[model samples]
Target: MAQRLLLRRFLASVISRKPPQGRWAPLISRALQTPPHSPGDLTVTSSQARPLYTTRVCSTTFNIQDGPPDFQDRVVNSETPVVVDFHAQWCGPCKILGPRLEKVVAKQHGKVVRAKVDIDDHTDLAIEYEVSAVPTVLAIKNGDVVDKFVGIKDEDPLEAFMKKLIA
Candidate 1:
C-alpha cells in the first residue's frame, strides 16, 4: 500500500509538468552518437592543465602597496575629488567593500579618482586621518576630507554625496 501511494505521487509530479524534450534532444543524441575517447587520446600535461594567472582585469590587479613618498602631494593635492579607501589585507569586510569601491570609481571615472591605503602598512596615514575601522572611505577635496564613511555603505548615498561635493 505504501509503495502504491509513493508511485501515485511520483506519477502526479511527472504529469504536472511538460518533460524537457527539444532542449535535451540534441545532447542525448550527441552522447549516443559519439564514441568515448580513450585516456591515451587526451594529451593535456600538468603544465597545460594548470593555467597561469593571465587576463587579469584592471580592477582585480589593484593592490595597496607602499604609498608614494609624497602621498599627500599626489592624493590631497589633486584637482579632482580623491576617494581614499583605508583598508587592511586581513580584514574580511575590507575585502568585500574593496570591489564595491572600485565599481564606484569606474562609475565616476573622470570626476573622481580612487586610491587605497593599507592601514597595516601605512599606520601614520591611518592615524593622521583618525581611521579606526577596516573599511573607511574618505572623500578629499582641496586637500581636506569633505566626507567619510565607515563600513559598507549604499552606492546611491555615496554617489550623491560625491556629486554634491563635486558640484
Candidate 2:
C-alpha cells in the first residue's frame, strides 16, 4: 500500500512539473502562424528609402525668393552671411553642385545660411539676378550681393569667400 501511495505521489509531482498544455500551446501555435518576411513583401518608406546623410541634406536645403518681398529679412537680415544656390531639377551641374554646397552649408550652419532658388519655379527672381545659367551661387552679406560664382566651383574658394563676408 505504501509503495502504491509513493508511486501516485511521484506521478502527481511529474504531472505538476509539466506546464498546463493548453496554456502556452495556443500562444506558441499563434506565434508560429505568423508568416516570415519575404523580400517581395518588403516596402520602403520615404524616410527609410534613403540613407541618413542623404536625408539630412534633403532636409537642410532651403528655398528663397528674390527682390523686396522680405528677401532681406530671410537672408540678408540674418546675422550670418547667406549663400544662395540658384538651381533647377533638370540641370546636371546643379545636381552635382547641390550636394557639395549642402555639405559646406551643414558644416557652417551657425556661421552661414544656405538658400536655394529653383529658377524654373521662381523665374522673376532668376531674371532679377540675371541667372543666365544654372548653378549660380551668390554670397550675400548685409543685404548686398558680395560675391558670385556662375558655375560649379571648389568648396575652398567658396568657403574662403564666405569667411571674408562673415568676418
Which one wins on lDDT?
2
lDDT of 2 by residue, 32-133 (tens): 232455665543222332222223333445677555464657876866678888899999999888888888777776677788888887888889888899
Off by over 4 Å in 1: 1-68
Clash count per candidate: 0, 0
Evaluated against the true structure, the overall lDDT of model 1 is: 0.69
lDDT score of residue 121 within candidate 1: 86
Cα distance off (Å), candidate 1, residue 41? 22
